[model samples]
Target: MAKVRSMFREVLLKQGQLSVEDVTTMVMCKPKLLPLKSLTLAKLENMQQAAQDTVRQQEMAEKENGK
Candidate 1:
């Protein structure tokens, strides 16, 4: 269980989305909330949405700065 959690943390770090603190807090609070496969899929979807939000925010910031 420890090894699996460590590996999951590493993967989340490499993806560059959630911070280590965020992952740690989540794991501590809701360790078994989702099944393994569902958790993996949810993480991927979350990462995608985060990236999209980041892009949108950057565009908005650029427009504001230009004005």
Candidate 2:
């Protein structure tokens, strides 16, 4: 499970489809053992940041569209 999660994180990060905050939120929401928590948090943070940037860009586009 950890390996799968790690792979997913890496792929998403590489694709620039997620931000650290998004990853952090996923870590907080997902059920994980104590030992995995810290590492997961770090991974999530990277994804979340990317996700945040994407959101910001989308919002800006929407505002320009006015709808």
Candidate 3:
């Protein structure tokens, strides 16, 4: 099956032997459940919360020192 090095003598359809007859059928599958939030988004939220907590603690310490 290695003889198609033609210099163009014209091929009028005579290379048929790759039969892949597929019948269509309805396939009811599970609905793809996706995460409400992505990994990066969740991580960013956690980081933001941690940063806010740290800032709050620092502010509280400042208030205590001022008092």
Candidate 4:
């Protein structure tokens, strides 16, 4: 598990998706994003962020259309 986590962390860092501080922050919030199997905690957080942005954009579009 440690090796897997390390590799995934390196990939995310290299891809510029996460910074050192972000990794530390996620480590502290691991429990909150638990019950995850396929994705590591960091990836889960990224997915959550993407989902939130999508929802926000959709809501804005809806409001604009209704206006």
- lDDT of each residue in 29-61, candidate 3, tens digit only: 999999999999999999999999999999999
In order of appearance, the predictions have TM-scores of 0.43, 0.37, 0.57, 0.42
Q: RMSD, each candidate, Å?
A: 26.1, 28.4, 10.8, 24.1
> Which residue pairs in model 4 clash with each other?
none
For model 1 the local lDDT of residue 51 reads 100
Q: How close is candidate 1 to the true structure, as a TM-score?
A: 0.43
Q: Rate the local accuracy (lDDT) of all candidates.
A: 0.75, 0.74, 0.90, 0.72
lDDT of 4 by residue, 1-67 (tens): 4534453433434454653553444334444554545557779889899999999999999999999
Model 4 quality (TM-score): 0.42
Best by the TM-score measure: 3
Q: Which stretches of candidate 1 lie over 4 Å from their true place?
A: 1-37
How does model 4 fare in lDDT?
Answer: 0.72
Better of 2 and 3 by TM-score: 3
Best first by TM-score, ranked: 3, 1, 4, 2
Per-residue error (Å), model 3, residue 58: 0.5
| Clashes (N, CA, C under 3 Å) per candidate | 0, 16, 0, 0
Question: For residues 1-67, what per-residue lDDT tens digits would candidate 2 score against the true structure?
Answer: 3534443433435454654453444334766556745877989998999999999999999999996
Worst 10 residues of 4 by lDDT: 3-12
Which prediction has the highest lDDT against the true structure?
Answer: 3
lDDT at position 42, candidate 1 = 88
Clashing pairs in 1: none
